[model samples]
Target chain A: MELIIDRLTKQYKNKIAVDRISLTLNKGVYGLLGANGSGKTTLMRMLCGVLKPTSGEVKFNGIDVSQEEYRDSLGYLPQDFGYYPEFTAYEFLLYMASLKGLAKQSAKDKAKELLELVSLSDSAKKKIKTYSGGMKQRLGIAQAILNNPKILILDEPTAGLDPKERVRFRNLISQLGTDRIILLSTHIVSDIENIAGMILIMKDGQIVHKGGLDEIIKAIDGRVFECTVDAGEAGKLISMHTITNFRQENDKTFLRLICDKSPCENAISVKATLEDLYLYYFKEVNTDEKLF
Target chain B: MDNNIKRKLKSVFEAPMPAKKDDFLNQLDYPKASRLDFIKSQAGYIRKQVWVLSLLLFIGTLILMYYFEVSDSVIWILSSALPFISLVSIGEIFRSITYNMDELEMSCKHNFLEISLIRFGILGLANLAVLISLLILLAGKTDFGFFRLGLYLTTPYLLNCYGSIFAVNRLKNREIVYVCGVVTASVSILNALFTTQINDIYTDKYWSFWIISFIILAVFSYKEILKLIKKMEELKWSLSLTV
Candidate 1:
């Protein structure tokens, strides 16, 4: 199966939320990496057919997203959503199942199966408002997959999960991604590094980079350096380089940074990671078309 | 690994499940939920209180009709109270937006547009049933035709619904129910004023005016319903305005 996003654009009165962009997705997990206000949520909303675009279209196979036929095979989890306060997790899933057009018996069976799949069967009868943020998120995932959708779009799915819950979510996503066109967007660099097969970097409403991890990491390969220096020298290096991470132990400060070359005499070149690349682009103020 | 666990794992892997992808997917039957099934489901989503209040009002109308032999007062009482049946429904039906669940609902196979139309359709049919029921109860007491009685009862209901829906679409937040209540109260009071102060406004002397007003209000209410549908479809605009 294939999902094609063709020149999708959403413009507000004063600003363009999502620029004219296009993508062709096959059955794999795609990670959209962008900072807040970078149009990741806006693009996902368009693909889900919840928001009308100023221009362009999204289609699965040949079916346009605006058509009910397209939505029949689609699922989405928005960055923020809430449930009716009175609905239990079970009731909520059944409601979503009906919305997805499942028959009554089928809706019941699917809701039961999904509660187990998401490790929420024990809490199935509990009101949604009583669940933890992670539990609520898992319920959201369960509802999205009630119809066994072919195209799954999750916006910041792991935004507020604890470490254990994040790992569970990642494994769940990895498992679900094997047979669906799953596109998940997040600013959490490691979430993509761990779970996504393809990475798309968005900046200022445009896709600045798209590639596999190895290819994307090449931009900072051998250019990442680390060193332990006195506080005074550490401050200087921090100001001069794009430091992805830094810590001070005793009087010496340790720095992991991205640069064209080692900025210190004693600094050694280290392997670059996605976090470094993410920091170099987002945290650093270089306005170049390509990373140095 | 423990020997027992290792053996169990090996056994499970050796007996790996069959693909059955198409067979299992066929069991889902995602597209089978017909429009009628979806419409049937919407009635339950409307708040319990709305249904209770509507039933209570209908009963109250029945008891009140026993005392008033005058067709004008019967029509006045039924029209003022029944529009609330429409007023509270508009508030409760669109509570998905107030609860922030509309976005999630909009992405579903049925989507928001179909859901809104179905919900409004179901409630509208119920409101019509109540109007007709009241008319049947008072049919023998009135000198006017059944058609004219229907016009009088429907006009005020339409007026109240038009005002509340207009207010609900224009406003935001959970307090929308209160706004609708104000609309219902205002329409009821104005209907009361017309009943007592105008003397012959609800009498046979003004059946023609009632007919004209009913026609105009029904058109305006229908137009307002169309506007509500259009606004519900443009949910993003309203959502962004709130943000």
Candidate 2:
């Protein structure tokens, strides 16, 4: 299903969490990349029908979300999900399924299937209170997919996961994006770099950039440069270029830096990445291109 | 030419399939499900209270039988406790229902005010208990009737206590009000029950006191109900904006 978000706005007292942003999302993986407090979570919450916006309309396939029919095709995983401490993993899933109107036998079968899908089948009978953070996140993912929703919104789904689990979750999301509109929001740039069909960069409640992964990288084209300088000269290079990140070897400093195309003695060209683009957009400087 | 034929063949095989009907059962109307869920959840709490009160009354009946050496029939006393127990259970059930409704609103999910009239049903049972107790006393069986009245009075007091505890736990902002209301109402009922001078007053005066006490209790409980209703309204507004 396609989702249309029209002129969405959410103001908290004097601060605007989302400022009249609008976008149309179709069946693909859309990555919302921003720093913390950039309104990404608030936007996702509005889309999920959890937090109301000051002014906006969210419609799925031309159906308003206030109608029950829209909810039938929607799934959401909030950033901080609460669960009944007294319920076992299986029981909790069953309860949620019951709320969704699934019959007892089918809910049971779906609960077991989801637990296996999230690799939590062994802990299905265990109380949720005893689960680790990663396990709880996996369970949250399982619940979001229970109904095979058409529009899925997941906020920071892989925040606390280990490297292996993170890879597994990303792969799962990639597979899910084939027939559904999956919107994944996170501050981690690398998480969405490889999978997002389009990347939306937000800052101060406004989308600063929207394009494919290669386009975002291309924004910083010819600006990324690497150079090895003696420790004494490193300080000068740092002041001249936007130092995105750096590595050091004995007696020399290697820097991944961004600067307009210009003569730099011994500086070599390197490919820009999503992280480099993120730093370019979020870094604070007096230059016109500096995001902050 | 070969590519065009291959594309045509792919289109023939890949035409969208016809839509399938939902295999799952249709969702029950939320209002209907909410009412049923409320009743089912209350049944558990009410059942527990009935068991406790029944046990207490059964023991009391046996003790009275032994002390008075009255063997006309023990069935009457047992049967008398039945209506009283049911009345008390009804109050417990009402409290349970209100508690769940409050919880549903606090979580900002659904509305339940339409079902709130259920509370008056419990209040009616309170009135019935008092009427039965008065009838027994008028029949000239002072001892049995007074004891039954005491049991009947305990129902409302305990229900108020349970309701206050539930309100305090569920609505954090109004805990003090709920607690004070429960304590004051229970104290008034207890005082009416034990005071000899109060008992000697006219029957109309006694009934008026009970009526006034309940009215005050209802008024206090209604404040919390209003708070719950306001919260539900806010949630609904929020849902609309977000959706």
Candidate 3:
């Protein structure tokens, strides 16, 4: 069960959405972390065979991504997907099941089972437009796994989930990752911090970091620090380093930032987390904090 | 533990009768539907309004046929409206984009091209069925012979289809179908406007001309559908995404 992406590239009129990305994914959960418009969706679309890549190719085992045999083993949930509003959860799943080529009776059974698994069996008959954002997101997850796919690509799967729902989704995805390749993309660092076995960080249409959490965190491990200093000292530190977060308490300013060395004598080294690593690799700090 | 208990259990038909016995048998009869067979079943799942509207249009066509012999002008008007019967189906074939469900459907095992082809097939056949029914009814009722009667109606119908399909191929967004509607309606209106000029063709012997035109239109319509399929293979009905 290998998904091999070779030199994948996509270019739009004004920008290159994805450029020279190559990866070989196996049976595990891969968390694709990137800011918005960072090519996560574009890459996922190519893997799903929905959008043709401008260059290079994607293959599962040996079948090309564009082949029907390849698509038969693939499943995807887009960052944004639309369901027929009038359809009930049951109807929508059955519709998706039919598209996946499942027999009618079996499709019904699978829809029922998935709705139950997603904790939506009670509302199975309710119209989709009436469902909450979290409910709809869970529904999207259900549809993606309807085919028992070997390769499941979920783009921003937890975008609208509540805290409890996010936990539920994480657990469900962990269970699925044991035997299939599950790649989920999101900007929310916490979503993948616990469940994903591997992390892929994309920036400016290219993968700048990818590995296990610890492996990827090594890039900025000792560079992260937290310090509380007077407002005048904070201003000097802000100009010199990337401040991930800041807060003002009393006469002092507390800052969590990344830099080559401590900007102040009071700055203490802190263990870098996936969030710190994420924010580090995310947009460059604008240093917009005000301490006046 | 006893042979008698085992026999009794067998006689009782326990074990839940294989859980949905009828469905198991049905499943055997109907394997997982793919391609054409799956498309056949999808007909029921497509929005019911599509078929209902087509049926209503068919009924309206029947009503117009009822009043066909009122006068030459009425006959011309009925002939002009025949294409719209088929045009009602064009909007529905590309409805996934209109409703924004295309991305979800595009990733299916069938892919967007195959799925849209199925939709195209269903709507096209339905349009043909409506036209064929109208043609049959008019065959006995009209002053023109069967072939001659067909030429008048089919010419406009084919024009509408080709024009609508061209709009689908050349344009982008949800409004492509509306463009189809406008272009088809315009063709019909143009047909209606030049009734005297058209009647002149009938007065003079234009059988060779009509037959040749019919054959060319049919071939081009088929070719246009093929082109749309090829374009969709590359573009996947998603104009928002750059190819």
Candidate with top lDDT is 1
Which runs in model 1 stand beyond 4 Å of their true positions? A284-292, B1-31, B67-74, B172-175, B234-243
CAPRI-style quality class for the chain A–B interface of candidate 2: incorrect
How far off is residue B6 in model 2, in Å?
A: 33
Give model 2's DockQ, 2 decimals. 0.10
**Chain A fold similarity by TM-score, each prediction:** 0.95, 0.94, 0.96
Please give, for residues A1-292, the per-residue lDDT of candidate 3 as tens digits: 8999999998877789999999999999999988767888889998888888889999899999888788778788988888776899999998898888888888898899899999999999999999998999999999998888889999999989999999999998998898789999987899889889999999878998899988989999899999999989999988877788899999999999999988789889999999988777763522222332
Q: What TM-score does model 1 achieve against the real structure?
A: 0.90
Docking verdict class for candidate 3: acceptable
Q: Considering only N, C-alpha and C atoms within 3 Å, which residue pairs clash in candidate 3?
A: none
In order, candidate lDDTs are 0.83, 0.65, 0.81
Superposed by TM-score, candidate 1 places the C-alpha of residue B123 at a distance from the truth, in angstroms, of 0.7
Rank ordering of all candidates by lDDT, starting from the highest: 1, 3, 2
Q: What TM-scores do the predictions have? A: 0.90, 0.69, 0.88
lDDT of 2 at B60: 73
lDDT (0-100) at residue A8 of candidate 2? 92
